[model samples]
Target: MNNKQQIEKMTDMMSKFIALVSYKLPDDVENKLKELSDEETNPLAKTIYNTMEENQNLAQELKRPSCQDTGVLQFFIKCGQNFPLIGQLEKILRDSVYQSTLDTPLRHNSVETFDEYNTGKNIGKGTPSIFWEIEEESDKVEIYTYMAGGGCSLPGAATVLMPGEGYETVVKFVLDRMTSYGINACPPLLVGVGVGTSVETAALNSKLALMRSVESKSENENAAKMEKLLEDGINAIGLGPQGLKGAKSVMGVNVVNTARHPSTIGVAVNTGCWSHRRGKITFDSDLNYEINTHKGVKL
Candidate 1:
């Protein structure tokens, strides 16, 4: 196919994939929720889990969005330097967002800053925010599509801590935020904690952390240990499912970190609510695709 045809095909596939993501939770998330539900002992918490499961089922059966607030769309792309569509990748993603807005009927969540006007199309100055990572000597592009609802997105925070404060302070910062505002994001949340050299980097890493599988542990030994401690500490808070009090406060705590400057310890927190709507799609040089986050499904 010509470039125009290739772009059109990819766009169409992405539009449908976005719509699918809206209605279906990724396999890791769905499985985690199920495990949590089975482990929960409280009657009310169990009921809430049941309702959540029902919601998922109904959304898929009816081909409708699981949550009313689809939030803002964000794409985290790891593009191969040699990927054929590298030049057109940005335009393709933008077009996919526009097409998905209409086809998936995503909630109009993009609003112009200062102007206070809705974009209606979910495309504005920076709507459908895209983050890219270019891979060397590769021929496959991996794209992560995430829908960050307002409730969950609202709890995101980043800060630079004094060097002396140490990693203990990082734990304290995350705990403080989770206890104070995590309830607003809906319970059984998947928490993403990022540690880097600065606020911006930390913030971005925090969001990236959210995209990791709930079952995956950080490669860094210290970071992995921190993930366990934070997960236990957060669950100890008793936020439970829907924050109504249950056996666990969160689905998981994921930490993504990078070496930081000696002068500062930057940390950030991002949460994904019960219905964490995100998916991963990878395309080869030939444009063949594989959906990693969701299985037994085709776009």
Candidate 2:
């Protein structure tokens, strides 16, 4: 196919994929929520879980988005240096998002900074934010599309602690943030924590951590253990579905850590609500594609 054809094809695929992701939670996430609901002992929590399940079912059956806030589109791209469509990638993605907004009936979430006017097309200066990571060894491009809604974004917090504070402070910081703000984030959330040398790095890492599978664990032994500990502690708080007081506060807590400066330990926390609207797709140099997050996904 020619460059124009490639752009059109990719744009079509992305628009369809965005619509699919808006309405469906991945199979693993769905299963996790089911397990949590079955294991929960609180009546109120159980009712909330049922409501969430119903919401998903209705969204799928009616071919509608699961939530009203479709969220600003964000793409995390890992593009191979030699990919055929490399030159046209960014423009194609921008066009895809803009087209998808109208084609999928996506909510108009992008607004101009000072004018404060809705673009209505979901495309504007720095909108449909794209983060690029170039790789040398592969011939395929992989992309992660995430929808961070208002509720989930509300509880995001970050801080730079004195190095003297140590890892214990990291743990405390996450817990404190969850306790103070997580309730507003629409519970049964996936908590992402980033620990690094500065606030910006920490914030970026925290967002990246959310892209990891809900069932996955950190590679570092210490981090893995801390993940489990936080998971248990948070669940014990009984935040239950939508924070109505239940047996589980989170789907998981993923901590991504890196070496930090001796003087400062920065931490950032972000959450994905039960809807957790995100999807992953990989495309070969030939434009053949795979959608891994949803089962029997045709697009």
Candidate 3:
């Protein structure tokens, strides 16, 4: 195909992908939900899990969005210098989201900031936020697509700490937020925690943490340990499915960290609801693609 044809093809693929994730949970998320369901002993929580499963089944059978709030689209991209459509990716993703909004009949979620009006097409100025990382010596691009719903990612929290506060303060910040607003996210949630030198960096890293697989751990040993500690602590809260209280409160806790200034600590927390509409797709130089999040699925 010519360059124009390639671009069109990519856009179509992405729109289909958006539609796919709108209704179907990622494989890891599905399995984790099932695992949580099987382990639960509370009658109410078990019934809630069953209802969630049934909702997915009905959504797939009807080919409709599983949630009423389809969410604002977000893309985290890692593109290689040799990727053929490096320059056109931003436009392509925007176009794809617009197309998906129409084709999937996604809820109109993009309202221009301070302009006070819904764009109706889900594509406004920076509506579908895109974050990028450029790879040096490869010919493939990997993209993580996420639906940041109003109750989850949109309500994420961040804070800066004094030098004496330490990491314990970070834990307190996260737990406090969870206790206050975790139910608003429709738990059990997949929690993403980020620690960096600034609020913006921490917030961005927190979103990146949500893009990871449900079971992924940070490469840093301390961060991994924090993940486990936080997971245990959150589960101890018994937020359960739909925040009704049960055996578990979260799918997992993922921590992502960066070296921070010696005098300061910055922390943020973001979350994904049980449906966790996060997907990873990779395209090579020739545009051959692989779906990493949902197995045995095609777009």
Per-residue alpha-carbon lDDT of model 2 for 1-299, expressed as tens digits?
88888889988998888888888888778988999999988888888899999999999988788999999888999999998888888888888887878877789998899999998988889978888999997889999999988889988889999988888888899889889989888899999999999998899889998888888899999999989999998888888899888878999889898888889999999999998988999999988999988878786
Query: Can you write out model 3's per-residue Cα lDDT over 217-248, one digit (the tens) per residue?
Result: 88999899999999999999999999999999
Index of the highest-TM-score prediction: 1
Off by over 4 Å in 2: none
Against the hidden true structure, what lDDT does model 2 obtain?
Answer: 0.89
Please list the residue runs of candidate 1 whose C-alpha ends up more than 4 Å from where it truly belongs after superposition.
none
Superposed by TM-score, candidate 2 places the C-alpha of residue 105 at a distance from the truth, in angstroms, of 1.2
Report the alpha-carbon TM-score of model 3 versus the true structure: 0.98
| Residue range 1-299, candidate 1, lDDT tens digits | 88888889898988999999999999999999999999999999999999999999999999889999998999999999999999999888888988989988889999999999998988889778999999999989999999999999988999999999999999999999999999999989999999999999999999999999988999999999999999999999999888999999888899999889999999999999999999999999878899999998998
How many collisions per candidate?
A: 0, 0, 0
TM-scores, each model vs. reference: 0.99, 0.97, 0.98
Highest lDDT scorer: 1
